[model samples]
Target: MIGILGFVAVFAGGRWLGWAARWVWLLAWGWLLVLLLAHAPYMPPELGAFVGGEFRGWFVLGVLAALALAYRTGLRRLQGRVAPVVAEARPGAFSAVELDRYARHILLREIGGPGQKRLKAAKVLVVGAGGLGSPALLYLAASGVGVIGVIDGDAVEGSNLQRQIIHTDARIGMPKVFSADVAMKALNPFIEVRPYHRQLEEGFAAELVAEYDLVLDGTDNFDTRYLVNRVCAAAGKPLISAAITQWEGQISLYDPTHGGPCFECVFPVRPAPGMVPTCAEAGVAAPLPGVIGAMMAMEAVKHLTGAGQGLRGRLMIHDALYAETRVIGVKRRAGCAACGGG
Candidate 1:
């Protein structure tokens, strides 16, 4: 490089002047800088060596800049690998079995590990372990809700087999709550199943509703449904209620505390006697409860996990005969008696 610079400088001095001379001078200086950086040694060597003078400064600066850039690149690579480990090590995280069991849920961006944690921390009370409650209870348990409480006094019978899939022929005559408990436990041993083994009457309703974060009403009678709605409204808990008669079924999530209507707001006055018939009276289709009960369970899971939008303020109606469905918006009644006229 020095030999080349010498030749250019000689030519500039001989034939070139002014601008041409300046260009040659610039080229010479650039070549010298390249040699100092690329060929010079930055490490300590014999004192006053050839590469030790001012050129050492240039070599040292170049080495320092290279090291800084390499350090930054390495740090980014290390962080990329450490982030997943840190997230996996979060406090109170899931076990290997839990991760495996809920792999599909975790894979969903809307309902991943954090959503599953919310579900596990949730406490849900299902009123009535009959028709609608059967599938609802099974699904809630299978979804790994932390605590599930079921209240019912009715016993499983042969007639319930048509729509209530949670009970078996062998479990007939067993109290509905206990039967639900057995089924739920068998589905997921990680969850706790509390069987009330009694009716959800006036005296017990409030206390039971207060114990849970959410309530699901699947009772067969309008009186029980009204009672459960009033109790849930008083306790400031969300309620998922579903009912089916004949070939039609309807489900909704009623929560006046949030932005939705309470059950009483939608049905201010229960249908007069002989107006709204019971499932037994009207003969509900076998798959009607299963369909509605699963929908109730779906709404419950959404509410607990904060995944998708729930059925809050929306009633979902299904007609099996026509194979059609529709959703209707419902609003909270400002003067609703059940919701304290709020």
Candidate 2:
């Protein structure tokens, strides 16, 4: 090549530039020869054909990567849809079999095997630990409600010992809410118990109540009682309201949407301090709270199991000392302060 360039430079009158350009071409051609020799010193026809194939290896890798990503994303979405698991209701760390753990409950015409399992999977939040809360907590926990949340901000006073069957002398100084949780869990290890040892108020109240499937208003005070009820109504949850004072007790279930009045409709606001005396002042019969709270649990279980006619539209009142029970039919108040058109 340099000889040809030299001949051209001699003919065209530029010999020095032609020499430099020929040297560059020689160096590039030498590198190319070295590369091919190192790769395959003696390349056969079949080896050349194999190496010259299209970039399908990279294409196959890309397809596989895309498929793997798609599968991962779909699997994650399915798992998210069924999260926050409820533990299976088989008796663990206990001797009762499936048939025995629920034998008494199953005997009731309302709760069959399917209904019993539904109760096992359901979660219930009881809003107090005083009078009405005592019996409700006991029965629901004993019946194997999978999850039970007790929300209260009080202590186990000596006066509360009679009606609140779950508390004991050792727990007298403990917080009422936490004591209730320990007692309920001890009664049935199959249950998961949570304690809300604070008052349920606006802003922070709805977030806690939203986690559970149903709400039970066993609170003794009026304002907090209405708070739980209205929050449940807003969240489209089933609300079971029970109130007891003096010798009187009432139990009712409300679904805010289906044209039934909510707690706000029943009591527009907290009553004045001395307007209606509390259990302490009016002096309730010792066993009255058990009657009310137990009824509250009953209504909540029925709502969860869908076992029988729910106490959705009717309010039940009980007068134990008088031995009288009354059923009051209630309708959704059109202009209820809390739940009206909300």
Candidate 3:
């Protein structure tokens, strides 16, 4: 009874003093060792009686305590190797897994924890899931945008495999938006992905654009571009629009509501049919869309997190063949039909 009391006192005292767990455990072990030695056969009979335990009983207790400590240590090591569960964190809060995943972004001076949190709370809409949209969507997902919406009517074709990195060969027959959804979710499971497996039209374009904070237009046709511009201008939403051809690509942030020109302000007249050839007609280079698409994604991140200077009121032209890039100044036209210079 005295031996047990000594052990309990040692442990309790160590804990009460806020000692390290290892030190507290060591002190408890020391007490047990002292008790064992007192009860040993070689020890004096009076000492053994005072300790109140047989030598063999104390020895068994020490062995059991060591076993328990070893078992606990091993269990802790196993738990350390296992991946943590990614629970659905509360709104505006981050999970442990998400924090580790975006540790790099959080470490950046421009995009610290507050900016990362903004990214996780933002919702962005990509108007196309084609060549330009592919890289933009992927980077947005990897950047931890909270909600991403992709819309496209076409199915993935074998030709898209060359530059559209998001879609796989197996998904050739899948709708572009669905394919984009799969890739984005596979990249980051924390964000929400909405796939509109149909073309954007007058019936739902306005309603759709209204649901998001920002819009990205990567469509190839003039009609869709004008329609997107019109809808975004009317809704006062910032639009990041980009286009790519054989070896050249251009991108701009058109937000007349925020001092930048709308798409129609820059290009007031659409070209006649066959004047500006489509990708199928002109055959775009494989990496052109990737370069411009990544720029679009970068601009989106900057816009959402307020990280750096965006392309608002500026047009960025990239010539991949010559490795040249230039930013030209542009302004909203007062007579423009879309935004009417706000």
Top candidate when judged by TM-score against the true structure: 3
Clashing pairs in 2: none
Least accurate stretch of 10 residues (summed lDDT) in model 1? 83-92
Among the numbered candidates, top lDDT falls to 3
Q: Compute each candidate's TM-score over C-alphas.
A: 0.72, 0.70, 0.74
Model 2 Cα lDDT, one tens digit per residue, 1-342: 332343344435534446565465455445334333333536565543443322343345446756986898899999999966443445333335546878888888878777777887888998888888888999999888888888888889887897788898889989998888888877776778889888788978889988999989887778787778878888888889888888888888888777677877766667888987878778888889988888888888888888778778788989887899989887777678678843
Each model's lDDT: 0.83, 0.77, 0.92
Against the true structure, candidate 1 reaches a TM-score of: 0.72
lDDT computed for candidate 2: 0.77
| Evaluation by lDDT, superior candidate among 1 and 2 | 1
lDDT of 3 by residue, 57-83 (tens): 888888998899899999999999999
lDDT of 1 by residue, 111-223 (tens): 98898998888899998888899899999988878889998888999999998999999999999888888888777877878899888889878987898999999998888
Query: How accurate locally is residue 335 in candidate 3, as Cα lDDT from 0 to 100?
Result: 82
- Candidate 1 regions with alpha-carbon error over 4 angstroms: 1-91
Whole-model lDDT, model 3: 0.92
Model 3 sits at a Cα RMSD from the real structure of 14.8
Q: How far in Å is the alpha carbon of 81 misplaced in model 1?
A: 48
